[model samples]
Target: MEKLFELSHQNPALFVDILESIKDAIFISDHEGTTLWLNSASEAMCGVPKNKITGRNVRDLEKEGLFKPSVLRMALEEGKNVSTVQTVGEGRKYIATGHLVKNKEGKVIAAVAHLRDITDAVKNTSKLQEIEELLEKYSAQIRKLTSTKTNINGVENVKLGGKSNSRILAKKIIEKIAAVDTTALIVGETGTGKSLAAEKIHLLSKRRNGPFVQINCASLPESLLESELFGYEKGSFTGATSKGKTGLIKAAEAGTLFLDEIGEVPLHLQTKILHFLQSKTYMPIGAREPRNADVRIIAATNRDLEQMVEEGTFRSDLFYRLNILTVKIPSLRESRDDIEDLATYFLNMFNEKYNKNKRFSNEVLKKLIQYSWPGNIRELENLIERLVILSEDEFIEEKDLPQKMVEQHMSSNSPYISDRGTMTEILEEMEKKMIIDALEKENSTRKAAKFLGVSQSLLMRRIKKYNIQLVVEESKTFVK
Candidate 1:
């Protein structure tokens, strides 16, 4: 130790180099709290050179906005170790740990502080909060559309309104699971009403009076996900909110906590979740003690948990715990028999909403049913609402359907040869057909350009390029 000290004294530049090599900023001050030296990291963090900061009192530097509530000053004043969150400039945050260096006589000789940059973690947490708020806003809108209301029995009824046998069986399974208070898993493809089913289960459960908090596990990064789920205490880490946060698990206290896309949870966090499931307790980020929560968990996922377990991406024990009461929701294609009813329901709902008397023509409805709805119920509802608001005619014709749907319905009669054509030829034919249809419907190049989402000059050029024949009458253009 004496030799090491002698070496440091002999090669002071080497010691300085070692201190400068550290990523964390290091600030050194005399017992009077006057800056003695600062490393390169400190200069970058404070946006000030060492020559300017040296010999300047910490109080003056604090006032000058280099850093607020100086840790070195606190350490000097208290004659002990001090730790605090320091703000440098407008959004950058740092954790500064300061300690007094004492001589052999117990006299404080200097104060040193180590600062770690924490801006990214703070920004990520803020972003996660914003995303959660936005998700809540959309969920509220969905609730309004689904008409979440209290019935005569005082139970919130979320109408999974469908007549298909598969849907009915899924609903029945959900109801049966809701009767018993246990962990549940809802399995289905995306847009197949997994979230809605989770809500229905929560409403039917004994904890209906409590809150139902739902979070999409896949929407956040792993760094933010753990804190969001279990929460963190105030003053626990740099840039944490002053009042801290109540995690989603705690928010659902006596009710259901629906974890959407549970398969996306990181492998490391799976252990924590499993522990919580087993003991009804979890430890928040930076927390010293475990906290208990009485919330029932309902996890939903499009990915097969069993397959994930086999592949080692998901924990088998956690999967087994969550799969206690499983409810599988069928996709819209699997329940095509209920498409007409579901479509009509959405149509009437949207018609009332828009104060329109729009009705789907039999042909349009037939076309809708014929198309394979890859996006499931959600897509169907969105299409119906769009038709209600956008269709000028009272009866929504087959032509009002989206171009992709129209093309799919008429693929058998399509002009482009699928097997014997180059990509360019097929695309050109498709473009020509779209231009002809738009010209016929709009009767004007300007209006057709708007419909086709192309500039007027570009549309004109395309017309000339394709050698499209146009019959002009007065100011209107007709497809020849």
Candidate 2:
């Protein structure tokens, strides 16, 4: 040790050359925490030159909560080495190690520390976590496909039928997952058969015979969601069932758990979910032992999760995990070619459900093709159900459809309206039509504004401009 110190003093340039060769930042500080020496790497790490770091107290570099005094205390007083993962310089992560340096008398003289950048390692870890989540999702989907009983009650088996686009997309997804296990995130507007795509993935996976559980994250509160997903012991909390319930995760053991509307899951819960996706295990509420989960996870959401991540609502790590094998379901408006087939399928489905043999009139078919269905297949299904139940004649005509749908047809067919009108006029007409349509569809301007893509003030202005009559509540009216 004496010989080394002599060499360092006599050949300070050589000593600095050795230290600078290391990729990690290396520094020496006196017992009082004053910086004595630092290598070139320190300049790169701290964004300051070695000359600036020397003759300065380490504490003066105070970077918020990073580089706690406790670390230096441990190296100096305890005479021990310490290591921790810390964020440096605007949140860049580093693995820092500190060690004490002793004099000839065995008394601590100074402390030395090194910091290695681990940003890439952190990023790779995040990607691995995502891949694991995708695997779990696929596993859950396999179980759902293999099981005969559907998870959703009262939802009859929907035959896999759609336009060429839907079929082609579905086939592509199935083919991709044929060999590997990866969690899949299905994204689309509401009612675009995202759930159906999830089911198909399960059916094609190796875990086909396992259970497939589905939950809507947006439909439940955070407190209740924890119990619903991870399950709770009996008397875990108020309103708890007597029989301790197994969480959907455990229930889906060796199967698949589908989390729909995953974007709505609370922020705190996201951390726990990230842990589960990484470890494939979780502790049940009020349970001490960690329960092993062999389930795959498939998550679906209609919201923009990446945007949510940027807004700090969704965890970036969790988002990456669920996004490994993303399948975007096209909106109904985007896939107009599929409308005729989907409409016909729904007509047949309702025909069987209602025990009625009704067909679409030529006028009704043309209107259906021309109309842009904002609600996708679910909307189409409801419309078909209404037609089958209300239409007395064997054929469904334009008059038998909803008032808003009929108005859309009229607006499209109107000679007074031009597609290429001035922006102001076009917006005005659109506002008027949307407000009227929303009121007709939902029966209130407040609710209409929510769907009309405009503010209530604007809707009211258009309503006045078009001289639209507001319908107050009339005598009790019922229409079959």
Candidate 3:
């Protein structure tokens, strides 16, 4: 013990000098966020000697213009570590990260903070991001040109709506997962363009040159569907072809096989699909051995598979297998911001197809926006085609629109959405209320996360951000 004490005395600057020599600013504050100690670097960065700032409240430093808002004060208020950006002397940007200093008894005693100068790094990052954004835009244009030049069906028209957040999210999800060979399940209401999305994915994938095989499970009965998928040997069934035929799985070798209306697949076939997904092998009828194929599965369904699983109609294992890389597309009614753009696009497309020139009047376009499109994009496309063919006048007037559309347009104005500046403020207040309500209903962060479809850590961040009051202590136990 005496030898260790001598060594520590010989190298006391190892601790103090190192903290003083580091570039980042460092400081410590008490439970009340009163500055207790400030290292030499922090003192230099703030341009105030430690003797002047120590023993003073951190919030007071903000008032004195030593720095911007105090991250240490925020950490103390939130009872957790906090990070924020601050502008210091000479308009330089610094990133401050606050840590919650806990005692041996597991109670927070003080907060420590480290501030890093990031102005130059931030500028470089911004420039790099701008370059990347330009590259992404041109790459998309190139892909679109190729699709058009090659006359790719279904993919040429498949686009994420510009104005709808839901559609934007779906497009991002698709783009992110397309790089990997993961089984994808697309869920949406009928006519919501699930098949179009599948075609676009295949076109955008690494296997774009390979064939895209498609089939609708709902159009075939169990026996026929099975035989069609796993093509049989000659005389395997009553109407079998004289020569042995290849299955869709085999036909889509080294490509993508789209199974539309996947929910309609029978339970007996579900087992076969699961086996193939697990091992990429399927047995044909009247065949002694199984066949292996290299096909990527992209399944789409308009039904609730979870409900079907609970009712024992769908196998839980198959549901889990298909549920990877899920994407839920919004219905047309939920995408009001996209109505005008879609209507114009469809008008131009059908005009070219039918060799007619027809335009919608402003009033008719307004009516179209207000109408609740229960039949979704398919219905909209069909209606556009009909309007192009049936309307004798060059411009389709409001009177020509369906009667239901006019009635709905007159009553669709929402009362709560005026004054753009106030919208975010109102939404923030509502978000706070919702978090409190969800926490009350569930009494646990795990349930709250599930209810909100967000990570528990994010929920905790929001809780601290809002300083939400609670009736009971937050259930500290987390599920994952």
Candidate 4:
């Protein structure tokens, strides 16, 4: 058989080609650590050319805090084979194998090292770790659900679900009159958790153990509302019950009465309410006797009741009576800083409620913050619940958001949705543009895939299908 050195020297190109085809970087160095030969893979691994690497000591090209000199010294002086795994340049992982090369005389002559890129393996491991963590979280949440019962009365001392400022203000207002019997009027836009604030106020009050009666003035007609608020004697009206009916005011004796949509009360009923507020006395329908109510009233309205009073739609006297202590709830957009905390809170809440352990991706969180929540906290809570129920994965990605929200993000500057094109076409165009922009921003197909929440192969196919151009000029500018 021909000697191995003689064969390699004679067929250097063939040997080099074989090394290049092996995928792993292969490098040969002398006993003194001088590089002898390196393949194309080695050149790529070191970010240097094979010609430049040859005849140079590997230690001399050492980048501090990355590859250590001791690794090289052990491979050379100790004549021992060594292997190490290291992370290089941002998040790429490499597995390096070092072997002592021996001459025909059975003595060490040089060292050969091979490095394989294990970045994908490392990423999959990280993904597995994340999945394990999510599973553990799900398990813990399930255990809690099985062991604990949900509090139907809702959160205590905190607004049920709304902007942080509104919740804070509501808490403060609740704390202020928690020990007092003064009436409170909570005013805000619809779905701003006004009723929730009233409940919190009641829950924190001294009469919490007593019955809590809730009545909506707008839910019933003026005549029915009167009968509902005040008890009716037997045979008070044609459809009256055979037995006497107790009113909500009487039912809430020594307790709290939540009057929702209080502005909907008619003028005559407002007069009766004003009288009740002043004298704490009320009379049942068809009864020849007066009754005293020991109830604490908490009223809520989404209307500008003061304006209604000016327009003669509401009574100013009733407004003043209910507005003994007013708490104004702020809108969602006014408290943009609290969006993240609210989102997380709702995510966790639904995660436990539904037995799902879904997490919001950072991109989704960013989009949530960027959105102009016109429906305020209520809209956000509903959106989160929808995502939790609909999403299949453990993570709620940007794609999981409502299409309108995604469109709003893309057309942040566009005034109107283009009418010429179909909605599907518009959405496709938006997706293409967003994918291209993400690719341009990241400058890597892999990173772009992550940002777009798609697989690398899928992203590559889209890049080709959309004919998207990489911003080479922008990349050059970044390098500079």
Best by TM-score: 1
What overall lDDT, based on C-alpha atoms, would model 2 receive against the true structure?
0.74
Could you tell me how far off, in angstroms, the CA of residue 381 lies in candidate 4 after the best superposition?
Answer: 1.8
Model 2 bad stretches (over 4 Å): 1-158, 234-244, 410-480
> RMSD to the native, candidate 3?
27.7
* Models ranked on TM-score: 1, 2, 4, 3
User: Would you list the clashing residue pairs of candidate 4?
Assistant: none
In order of lDDT, best first, we have 1, 3, 2, 4
Comparing candidate 2 with candidate 4, which one achieves the higher lDDT? 2
In model 1, what is the error at residue 246, expressed in angstroms? 1.7
Give one digit per residue, the lDDT tens place, for model 4 in 393-435.
Answer: 9999988986657767667765456663887777677778667
lDDT of each: 0.83, 0.74, 0.77, 0.73
Best model per lDDT: 1
- lDDT score of model 4? 0.73
Of 3 and 4, the candidate ahead on lDDT is 3
Over the stretch 324-427, how does candidate 2's per-residue lDDT look in tens digits?
88888887788877778988988887899889999999989878877777767777777788899999899998899876676676666763766657768766
Give the alpha carbon lDDT tens digit for every residue of 285-335 in model 3. 778899998899999998899999999989999999999888887888888
